[model samples]
Target chain A: MDVYLPVAEMAVSPWLMIGLGFFVGAMSGVFGVGGGFLMTPLLMLLGIPAPTAVVAGANVAAAAATTSVLGHFERRGVDLRMGLVVSIGGVVGVSVGALLFAAMKAVGADEGLVRVAYVGLLGFVGFSITREAWQALARTRRGEEPAGGRVRNDLAHRLPWKVRFPRSRLYISVIPPLAIGFCVGVLSAIMGVGGGFLLIPLLIYVLHLPPSLVVGTSTFQVLVMASTTTFLQGSANGGLDLFLSGLLIGGAVVGAQIGIVIGRRMKGEQIRMVFGLLVLLVALRLAADLVLEPALMFSASPPGAGL
Target chain B: MTGLFRIILAVLACALAWVGAPARAQNRGRSAAGIDEAVLVTSSFNGARVTIFGTAPTSPSDLDVVVLVRGPDRPAWIGERQRFFGLWLGQKRLRFDAAPTYFGVASAKPLGQVAAPDTLALYGLTPESQLAVQAGDTGMEPEERDRLMREYARLRAREGLYVADAAGVQRLPGGLFRADLQMPDTTAPGLYTAKVMVFRNGRQLDSTLMTLVVSKIGLERVLYRFARNSPALHALLGVALALGAGFVASRVLRRVSVT
Candidate 1:
């Protein structure tokens, strides 16, 4: 059956939306990351305006991340104090980024410019992640020992405003994590992402958090950031469509459950490789839009379509 | 017969003058245009079909009912992308204000053959004449603005928001005629006016204006008002809703896993 979205001003199939939600949700479960980058562009391709798609995609990611954070809590891997500190910075960054988004929409640069930037950003992240994952997988298969984390520790020690996070058992400057959170928050707002994919690498390689705490911290931040993005976009641009978000959340919740079950049996390296390929596929699709001929040359959007 | 048509046209013109002249509507029996009622836009308002039924005089085949349904106007800009330095970017953007959110024209005959050019402009059947276009005519001629506006109208038409259907109006027996105006799902909520013009022998004989209220109602109204009036609270609520869903999913997942 078709459902009419009041805010989006369009009627779309509920089944199609639900299926997409399931797919992205499952991907999130397997990768232990909120799949906003993948979902946003996918929503846009399906004819949802950038504004609605941006906010709705974040809504889905936030739901999935919240579900995963519970698992982290069970394992005693989450550092609440650190998460809150980073979240504060992330919220500030999201507010600033939302303002920029509003300005961009006001000037009507929400089409070609947004698409071009989306493609470039996703393509770079996808390529780099895929290369690293593939190399790491190959090395493990060849029975090679994993690389040491010496450089990140040295950098962490050099930074100012040192603090101790007892939960993660690390004595490092709080500046690096706070700055990272802020930057990731901005990128999440602009790119319509949950910032989990970017955060995981920084948590693992830069701040050098334990493997157990990295995913938990990433999920903590994603849940907060994605929720913030969803609210700000809705408040600023009136982009949140309850009907659309409801369908997505319904499917995503179920998909996340299935992902947790499947994740139990899979190795970490294999999951990373699979996620890398998925990200690469999304990147290729977005790039095709930029390079290929468009069927329609002209398009029009309503006032304050996004913020 | 010619003298009779001239007299009738004068009376019809006097009666049809609804704009800025209410005193002239003194006639009890005159060519009038009205719709069933206002379309109440709710949450499920995908689109609506407004049946605009009106009455005319004399022969039905000889008379043409030209209904111009238009929504409230707003600012719009259409950018033309050209390959610049190995990247496709908007080279020239046509900026214009007062572009209708929705514009649809229904007529018994093609507008080109039904009414004169000046009459169509006065009635606002064409986008170029209807909208107040503001473009940078620095290196381009004034006609460029006209063509650009036409292009803008064409784009909107392709999107199904702007429609011009000649065969849309249906004649019902006597002098009664009706036109079904399809309100697209993408149409914005506002006051829409439908100018009903009756043309005979390629000349405007009589015209009447009908208005359609496409405003949000019920849940749609409440939600729209809340979002517009209290944006911060709305946004915070959005965040809360997402987190609630997330928390629900977490609990449900654990239950299924335990079983």
Candidate 2:
């Protein structure tokens, strides 16, 4: 059946929306990312206005994260203290990022520059993660102990204001997690993403979080950020489409459960390899959009179309 | 013979007055025109087919009927993508102060054949005439601005917004004529104007102006209004809905798996 989205002011197939939600939500569940980077562009391609698409994507991310994070909590996988500290920094960073976004928009050079930076950053990160996962997998295949272990001599241990996280079995300074969360928050605002991809990698490499705790903690952070973004977009920009978001969330809730089951079956390296490939795919697609000529050259917009 | 001649003269005088009075009154009064439907926008609204029916006093052969429908006006912009170092960068845009969100024209004959181009423009019968470019010193060349404006109209036409159909109007037996204009799914909801004009020999003789209201109704109406009036409350409602759905789904799925 076709459902009319009141805020977006369009009619779309409910089934199609649900299918889209399922696909993106499953990926979010497996990777512990909010999947905004994927959902926003896909919604826009389906002819939803950019602002409305962003709002809907964020809403789905928030809801999907909730389902997955709860499952993680039941398993005792999440580090609540660390997640809270990171989220505190994220909230402040998002506000600062919004201001920076406004300034960049005024200058009108933000899109091209930001896109180039995104492609470069994603490409480097994806390559390194994939390579590392491959070596780890090969070592297991050769019957050798896996190489990854908690690094004790990193700068994270030397920083002040150290606090112990009993859940993750670590005593580390709050500065690193806060700083990482702040950076992710800034990127989320500027790039219109959930910042889960960046956060997961930083948690593993910088803070050396245990493999079991990585997904849960990252998902916890995503839940907080996505909720903040959804609320801000709805109240301040007035872009949220409830009818659309409801359909997406319905599919996402189910998809997230399936994802959790599938994630449990796979080894950590397998998950990392799959996630790296996904990020790489997105980077390539974005690069192609910039380098290739668009099919439609002329663009038009009515008043109050975007935030 | 004189009595018969006087009666014939009286009949001829009456016929002349009947024919001449309409010609004189035509300039002052508009011919009758109406739309078949009130155009209510419901949840299943894909698009609407508006049938305009009217009667023309003049002979069908000599008269051409033109129907134009325009939706509400809003500010708009057309942008041409600029390139920098082989990469598509920002856009050089032309802002229009007020442009119709929807514009459709239907006529018995092609618009160009019915009247001179300038005349069509003079009466605001063309899309070019309806778009009012914001007048300012934007440092853009006149030719470039004109090109972008035409492109904008073309793009809207492609989207089924600005439509011009030559054979849309049909003449029936007697003086009855009808025209059908299709409103696409993307047609914005607002006050709309539908004009029916009578033209002869490239000159407009009479025209009637009518208004139509396209608005959301039922659940669609309630939601649209609620979002606009109380956005904060609406946001809270949306968040709660999402969170509740997630919580319920997880719990249910877990129980099902256990069984």
Candidate 3:
């Protein structure tokens, strides 16, 4: 049986939708990341109208991240202070990005250009993650630490506005995390993703946060950022369809739980390698979409045929 | 003189009898398929058209057709009343805002009243009627069948053009009609039916129906399948799969080291 989603203005099989949610949720739990990067594209492929897909992905990400964050808190894995600082910067960045999006639309910029840009961005991010993971994997095979030598704790020392993060046990300037957060937020807004895949790497390599705190804190930030995006996209675009979100979130939460259990068994190097490869694959797919002709390129509005 | 007059009368009677016999045969063709066989086709739109075609009988009579559209899918109704109003505010519109699911056409005039039924209904070459071909015991040639199909498709395309009911029915220059079909954005995706009715001399004769299917694919349908169904690819990149394998490999290596 098909259920009509009023907000999205489409009829969908509810059971199938819930099952997809479960799969994405599982990936999120296992990867220690929000699965928006995976979910959004998949939704688009399934023919959910683009706007609804973007907003609904954000909402589902927010919900799953919320559940994951609670688990992280229990493990004392989150750096609450750091998360808050980053979130503040993220909110500002998102506002800027959203304003830019509006400006571009007003100027009548071609939609194809926006899509090309998105594909390019994802491609770049995916390749970089894949490269890093491959390198890490090679080093582990030789029983050696990754060649990055120790992170430059020196860079943190020199920065102004230094703050103490007692939980991570590092006295680092707030500049790095805040800047990363802001940049990720802008990218998230422009691309309609949670930016967790981007954040995990930045936290590990740039901010030099401990691996345990890295995943937890980034997940926390993703939750907050995604929630903000959900609300903003919903109110602004009228794109948030609760019925669709509910089905996806319901599945995602269960999948995430299973993913986390699976993730616990993997070594750090293996996890990094797998995550990197996933990014690269996603990037390649996006690149192909941009460079190649789509099978059906015609634009169509939601069923009922009105734009 | 008397003999000549009788012979002329006899010839006139024979001529009249021959004409009368054919006329009765033609009338029988019209009566066999009573005038009440109307057909209807509908869709989830304010205005949609249904077309009906049959062989032209040996004789032509007035063709009456009426179009009635209704909502709610029960199929057993005939001759529902519909009002036609003049264009309102300079725009033609259906009385109701929503698209009606059932529409029909009925007319009482003899087919000859408008034009030769075949000439009026068939814009291009009218192929030998299927009945004629069958009665001749000669099946349609492959080329003929293909040509018929193409013609049918073209006719269908032409018939599909419609404006929303709000636009009312606009008559084209050549006895053709068009109406705007107002399909609401929130209209649910499903099969909708359209019905068409034909009449002769103010009496219903034949009826028929067809269906329109509306379908949609939403986000969840796209994303989940990619992740779950493509397990080979997923296994290649899945962090969990890597993690599980790594765990097992590490355990094996530890045992080897100890041994």
Candidate 4:
């Protein structure tokens, strides 16, 4: 059935939207990340306006995060303390990012900047993950400790304001995670992403937290970040559409549950490999958009439709 | 007897002119057309096919009918993406002083075949003719502007906001015909003008104008107004609902899937 979206002022097939939500939700559950990166592009591909796509992505991420976090808790591993600290920084980042979004809109640079950043970020993240996964696979075949089996020395280890997280059995500075969280928060707000893909890598590599604790902590933090963004973007820019969000959330919640069960059956190496490739595909699509000439030269947008 | 007949004929002609003068002056040389609805209140509007019925004074077979529906105009900007520092970003741009939010035109035959380009432009039946470019003379020649305007029209057509459907008007058995134009759900709400024109041998003969309103109503109206008028409240409500939806999803999933 077709449903009317009040904010977007369009009628869309509800089933199609639900199916998209399910697919993104499954990816989120398996990766223990908010699936906004995937959701936004897919929605745009389906012809939903960019503003509506971005806001709806955040809304779905919120619901998916909640579902994923609970699953992590049930499995009996998550660092609540670390999650809280990161969330605090994330809140600040979202506020700053929201302000920047508004300022950019005023200068007529918001959407252009957002698309460019999306391409750069996705490309970098995608290539790096695929490489990491391939190396890990080789190590396992040679009967050695898999690559990234242990956290490497990075700037996070050298940071000040050290704190202890007992659950992860790590003594690291609070500044690293907080700073990382802050950066991710700003980018996520601007790009309408959950920052989970970016966050999980940081938690695992930079913080060197236990693998079991990483997903839980990331999901918990994403929940807060996404919620903050959803409200800030809507209130500040009026980008959100309740009907679109509701359709997505309904399917994502169920899909996340199924994904949790399936993820448990898959190897970590395999999951990372697939996730990396998916990210790379999105990146390539964005690059292609830049390189190719558009069908029409001139375009027109309605007044007061900026941002 | 011949003289008496001539006087009677003169008097009859004067009476006919007196009666027709008021009616012709009132219409201002406009043809007659009636729209299905005068006010389109959009509640859960999924788009409506506006059926316009009209009759031309000439034989319907010999005349061509065109219907043009246009919404309120607003300013806009169109930017071109270019390579800058190894990154693709927006560069050169064209601004529009006035661009319609929605524009749809339908005719019995192709607009070009029914009327001359100049005639179409004068009547504002083509999308390219409707645009008022902001960069009217920014080192751009007349030909360049014409090409750019054509591109702009194509772009709008791709977005489904501006369309020119050739088979939009249908001929009827009598000297009457109907034109049906389907507005998508994304149609903007505002004051819209529906124009019906009659053409003979690539020249416009007569035209009529009918104004219809597309306005938000019921719950949709209230919500749209709230978002526009009280953005703070709208944002708060959006966030609260998001949080609530999260909470609800978790609770519901725990019962069914999470074991």
Candidate 5:
């Protein structure tokens, strides 16, 4: 059924919106990311305005994270101390990122430059994670004992303000997690994403967080960041549509629950491999857009548009 | 007997004029026109046909009826993509200070056949003529502005917001005529003005102006107003709704799965 979106001022099928939310929410639950990297573009393809699509994507991600985090808590997989520390840095980082984004726009930075940068970054991250995950998977399949020891004398350990996180069994400095969160936040604000994809890798490889606690902790951070973004985009830009958000959240919450169940069944390495593939796919899609000839050369919009 | 016949014919014409007078004003000239209904935008609104029915004093063969409907104006820009480093990048936009959100016109015959280009341009009959460019913008030549204006009109036409049909108006016996202009679903809700012009042999003899309101009502109106007026409150509500729904769904789903 079609319903008119108040803020977007367009008519769209409710079922289509809900279905999109469901798919993205499932990805969020399984991967512990907000999935705005996929949702925003899909909404735009459906003819919703860019700002409205971004806000609605954030709104749905927040709901999906909330639903999955509860499941994670029940499973005793969440590291509350770590989640809180990262979220504090995330909030500050997002604010700084928004300011930086405005400054870049003022300088008339070419949009093509940003896209090229994104393609390069995603390609590097996706390739490294996939290769690492595959090697680990192959070693296990060959009946070889997995490498269990991690180097403890890294820069993360050498930082100041060391804090004991009994949940993850780490006596590491809070600075690394905060800094990692800060970077994720900056990227999320600039790209209109939840930053879960980047956060997962940082928690897994950089912080050496326990695999059991990774998904839950990442989800908690995503919930915080997504909620902040939702509020900021809605209030600052006036693009949040309650009716559209309601439809998306309605589907996302249920989908997230199912995703949590699915995540519980999969091994951590397998999940990482799947996430790596997804990231690489997104990177490829973006690269193709940059390389291909665009169908439409002329565009129309109100002045001062944003991604 | 001939003189008496002429008097009778004059009396009939005056009666027809009185009968066809518009609701807002009495017909002082040879033509009168009014829209059948004011467009009301609702949830189920797709596109609507704005039907204008009227009478012309002369015979249908001698007169052509042209109708132009223009919606509220807003600021907009059209741009062509700029290429850099062998890649298509940002747009170089030209601004239209006040452009009609919806502009459509219909006539019994082709517009060029009905009136000269100067006359059509003078009345702001085309989208190109109506689009007002912002003055005092540097580095943009007049030729570039004209190209962008044409591009803007073409884009809007593709989106069904700008429409022109030469034979959209249908003429009936005894100087009666009706024109139906299709307003797409994308039409912005605001006050719209419909102008009905009567032309004879490339000259406009009479014109009538009528206004109709396109507005949202009920839930649509309430929500649109709430979003615009209280964005902070709306944002809070959106977040709260998502959080609450998420929490409730998790709890309910857990119970269902366990059982």
Candidate 6:
């Protein structure tokens, strides 16, 4: 049955949207990452207009993260100092990213450039995580200790203004997290994603944050960024449909609760492996879309055309 | 007296002869020509005017096309005078008109001359009588279909609803029928069928029916399908998947611990 959304002026099947929310929320809960990488594409497949889908997904993510963060706080899993520092960086990154997005649109290269970048970045992340997980699994079978991956001396770590995070016991300069946050924010704006998937890994490997704090911190930033995105998209584009967001968030919140409980029971490596596989799947799908023949190549006018 | 009687008798005979000749001629014409393929076009939506288009053999001085639409229940239309009063009363009395169960449009053109741009809007059909036209599902005959189309067209025109041009209607060069229809924004989302009837010389000749579907997209539409079918099962499965990944991650990290 179809339910009519008064604000959006659309009729939608409540059941379908809730299911999508459950799936994405589960992924987010399990991986300690934003499910934007999956949710945005999934929505597009369901024939939602791109702009609305992006804004709605971000809104739902914010609500879900807010609910999930409570559990993290209860467990004392959050590193407030790290989280705050990262958020500051993220806010700057978002501004930069938003500017870049506008520039890309002005130059008419937004679609092609964003697609290429998305596929490339997702593919890299997916392969690296999957490879690490697979090797670790093989080592366990042989009764050997897993390899401890170290951060390389990269430009990201060399930046100035380094701050120490006592909870994670990392003494690195605060600039790395800030830079990472900024980069993720920019990507979020460009790709219409929360950038949690990317941020978690960067925190763990590049910034040398403990794995326990990665998910919590990422979720924290996601909550803030997504909330901001919702407001901005709503006011700027008039694309945020509160009715749609409410439905998706309702299902997502429930799903996230279940996800968090399950996440607590599982081992850290297992979460990483699963997250890797999921990211790989998404990356492969996007890559295939780019390389393969499109089913339909027509570009029609956006909805509400011709007045 | 005889001369007057003769005159009267002759006048009566002439009048009788004139009437009798036409009847015979009509019978002969039917046998010789058979039924002509007449075309009628119409478009409409609920709570709107119905636009009628068709060709007829004779242009009648007065023509009336009747259209009928049936659909989901809806609101009523307040007359213009009431609307003005409503503004001052501070009581926005939203009149509830029933869903249009039937609508129609009629014109005075003969069956042969009906062409593009010569449209008639039938405003008599009430929303209570309007019915939605389910195009593919309704197993209506050709005549019934035509009638439905006329009804839908008239209703749509009256309501100021926009409809794509009909494919079934053959538009002559530079000749087309255009009519504005108004539809209440609150019309139910569903498949609706329309019927159109054409009248010439106060007689119904041909009618047709067409179908239209309305839909919307929202969060409920996007996620509810997966959630409803297997909410608990999916939740459990997701947990299982997460657990399985966690196990793998743990083993991997333990192995990496040595390196």
TM-score of chain B of each: 0.82, 0.86, 0.26, 0.78, 0.84, 0.30
Clashing pairs in 4: none
Better of 3 and 4 by lDDT: 4
Better of 1 and 6 by DockQ: 1
Indicate the worst ten consecutive residues by lDDT in candidate 4 chain B. B9-18
Per-prediction CA RMSD (Å): 7.5, 9.9, 19.9, 10.0, 8.2, 20.2
lDDT of 6 by residue, B1-259 (tens): 0111121101100000001111234322221111121111111111223233333222232333333333334332221111122221111111222434222222223223443222332322333124333444246565644454454444444433423332323322322222222233323444444444444443344444454434333443343333335444423332233333333433443355447
Query: Per-residue alpha-carbon lDDT of model 1 for B48-94, expressed as tens digits?
Result: 66666666654435767787888888777665555545555554667
Whole-model lDDT per candidate: 0.72, 0.81, 0.54, 0.74, 0.81, 0.55
Put down candidate 3 lDDT per residue, A189-263, tens digits, no spaces.
Answer: 877888888888888877777777876798788887887787677656655565677678767766666676677
**Whole-structure CA lDDT of model 3:** 0.54
Best of the candidates, DockQ: 5
User: Candidate 5: lDDT of A59?
Assistant: 95
Which portions of model 4 show Cα errors greater than 4 Å? A99-117, A146-158, A292-307, B1-27, B30-45, B59-64, B83-88, B135-142, B171-174, B199-206, B257-259
Model 2's alpha-carbon lDDT is: 0.81
Please identify which of the two predictions, 4 or 6, would achieve the higher TM-score against the true structure: 4
lDDT of residue B27 for candidate 3: 31
Best by lDDT: 2
| CAPRI band for model 6 | incorrect
User: For candidate 3 chain B, which ten residues in a row score worst on lDDT?
Assistant: B9-18
Taken in order, the candidates have interface RMSDs of 9.9, 14.1, 23.9, 13.6, 11.7, 23.8
DockQ each candidate and list the results. Answer: 0.28, 0.28, 0.04, 0.24, 0.31, 0.02
Error of 1 at B144 (Å): 3.9
lDDT of 4 by residue, A241-269 (tens): 77778788888887888888888887777
Q: Model 6, A1-307: lDDT tens per residue?
A: 3444433333456678888887777776767666777777787676565666787788767766765676677677778888887788887887788888899888756776787788889889988888877887888889997677545456555767756677877666777777788888888888888888888888777877777887888888887777666655555555555456656765676677678878999877788888888888888887776666555422222222100
Candidate 2 residue pairs in backbone clash: none
